[model samples]
Target: MIPPRFAVTEDQIAAVVAEFYTCVRQHPGLGPVFAAHVQDWPAHEAKITRFWKNAILFDRGYDGNPLAVHRAAGDVRIPMFDVWLGLFDSVLRRELPSETAAAWSALVHRIGRGLVFGLGQAEGAPPSLR
Candidate 1:
């Protein structure tokens, strides 16, 4: 059987990121955390855009180590992952078609799990195993 395909354009992804960050900046729980880490919004948004472009479109524009970056940020907590994912899901659902949102949410969920594990935030496993 052929795999399902979702057509996600770069413009749509950019709009999602932009709208998501706007929500993040206003969120009471997440806003302060992101504000502490992100000094310049435009630069951070550009970097994130490159990251999504690379991950979703195979654009090869992003090269930074996200795990290392998150680790260096020094403020990400385990429960924050849930908040981030929830916000991301809401924005994606609002901005994209259902199939496209599902596809992107799945990918982001995997990435969030890995990040949570990598940052030593997961409950059961040591960082080495993760």
Candidate 2:
């Protein structure tokens, strides 16, 4: 089973988030879009930290709506979503144990899918793709 807080320590979460962003920034297909959207990298990092903390561990510290945030980002293409998930999965795999990574992967996959699907719907596409 997954711990509500994901890792045992906040430092572990910080490490995972840092590594994930580092991977995304280096990925050829994803880096440009991320750079464009995340102009304020420090603020973006904090927002993502809160998002993951809330989603994976039920922490109430994060009040941002991730779906709405991505929806407002007009540059979020489908391939960008794919690359984001790929980087997240890859980085988490490198940072966490098998079981922890598995749990985190599942949640990240769902979040990524929802973000993409929300974009599709906003663009008048079918919801079935979700």
Worst 10 residues of 2 by lDDT: 1-10
Against the correct fold, how does model 2 do in TM-score?
0.84
Q: Tens-digit lDDT track for model 2 on 71-100?
A: 777777776777677778888888888888
- What are the models' TM-scores? 0.88, 0.84
Clashing pairs in 2: none
Task: Name the lDDT value of residue 54 in candidate 1.
Answer: 84
Error at 66, model 2, angstroms: 1.6
**Each prediction's Cα RMSD?**
3.9, 3.1
Worst 10 residues of 1 by lDDT: 121-130
lDDT of 2: 0.76
State how far residue 26 of model 2 sits from its true place (Å): 1.7
